[model samples]
Target chain A: MKTKKIATYGLLVSLAFILSYLESLFPIPIPIPGIKIGVANLVVMIALYGFGSTQAFVLSIIRIILVGFTFGNLSTMMYSLAGGLLSCLLMILFKKLKFFSMVGVSIIGGISHNIGQILMAILILESASIINYLPALLITGTITGTLIGIIGGLIEKRLKKFLVNY
Target chain B: MIKKNDFILIGIILAIVLLIWSLSFFKINWPMNFFMKTEGSKVRITVDGQEYKILDLDKDTTFSIEQENGKFNTFEIRDGYVDMIDASCPDKICVHQKEIHYDHETIVCLPNKVVLEIIDGQVNEVDSVAN
Candidate 1:
């Protein structure tokens, strides 16, 4: 059982890495910076629902660090760390509450992710005016988070049986 | 399947975003008619939170900025307008942005951490007061 868990997590990490790579391939160009679909969150969400918070957190960190080294700079790593950690935290909290389904949780995650990134932006730029981008970032977050939630829900439904045995 | 509450949440988020976006237009000291009358004769450039250079819009000239890592951005000040004509950043979003000459308007290149903001007059007293 222990070995199975390790193997499964490793596979999930690779899946997330691949998803991140795929997202960079065809970026949706909006006029704003730090905006993307963040498809890797789908894998993280799946890990959360399947194996709980510990597994989800592990996968999130590993994916961010590995991807940051492979395709990003120091600033990118910092932004990703801030956004990913906050997003994951919110996802776990919402999931525990059980008031909302996967979709709603994902939306919350997305919103918090943007908030986290903007916080980092404010700190790095040392300008409060950077907060002006909040509304736009939140809107983009909502749209992308909703999409990720829907996709995660479908994936979870299909893998439910296998996940239970694992 | 999405629930009724989910739709409500979406509506709330959309409404909030729209509210903030619309509110920005009415900010005090920001002339509603930006194009009709423009102020601010100086542009402040900063990189990675450090002041790089300041330029007077009254003088028309072109200059290039090369960063420590060999990345660069080129700017042109013509007819009292500042425009980023070229940049080494891959996205080129900064290069494609339109020129600016209004107070508080900013052009930001995220990858390069470069910011160009316009301020009114010789001194930024209003900005200090607001802050």
Candidate 2:
């Protein structure tokens, strides 16, 4: 059981890293700084549902670090850490509530991710004016988060069946 | 499994987003028109919450400001419109943003802590008139 759990975590980490790398390849035309499809969150979402919060937290941290080292700088790492940590916390909260499914949890995670990064931007810049972008960010977060949630729900269902057979 | 309630929740969230989105479009024009009655507006630049400089929109000029932290942003004011043509910030969000001519519009460079706001020069004139 121990070996299986470790193996699952290792695989999840690699999968998340690969998804982040793939996400960077797609260039979004919008110049808005903290906007992206966030394909990597899908992996995190799946991990949270499949294994649990502890494993999901570990996977998220490792994925952010590896992605930062490979494709980002110090500021990028700071933003990712802030966003990823908050998103993970919210996801766990919603998951425990049991009021919402994978889709709802993922949506909350996505929106929290943007809020965390925006807060970091405010602190780093020392400017309250950055709050001007809140409306647009929230809209984008909900749209992208819903899409990610749908994908995560489908994968989680498949993974459950596969794990049972294995 | 996504329950029926989840869809309702998402719908409510979307409605809230739609309201906020629409509100941004209706930004108060009262103050904007009040300021526009004057011949020209002034562009106020602030760095780290300190008033840096104010430029008249009547002049066509390009100027640059170098912050104490070594970052800089360049602005080009032409025909009463100001544009952030260049910035030393990592993301360059200000440079990519559209030019502004209306009163109270702002071009903000968060990484460099620079804020270029279009203020009504007439407000000061009005204050002086009151005095």
Best by DockQ: 2
Off by over 4 Å in 1: B27-43, B56-112, B117-131
Worst 10 residues of 1 chain B by lDDT: B28-37
- What digit string (tens of lDDT, one per residue) describes model 2 on residues B5-49? 678767877787667556545653222343454433989998867
Indicate the residue-level lDDT of B71 in model 2: 82
The TM-scores of chain A alone, one per candidate, are 0.96, 0.95
Give the Å error, residue B28, model 1.
4.8
Q: TM-score of every model?
A: 0.76, 0.74
Which candidate should be chosen as best, given lDDT against the real structure? 1
Tell me the TM-score of model 2: 0.74
Instruction: For residues A1-166, write the lDDT of model 1, one tens digit per residue.
Output: 9999889988999999999999878877663445778899999999999889989998999999999999888987888898999999989998898767788888888888888887888788865455656777888899998999999999999999999999
Off by over 4 Å in 2: A162-166, B29-106, B109-114, B117-131
- The candidate that wins on TM-score is 1
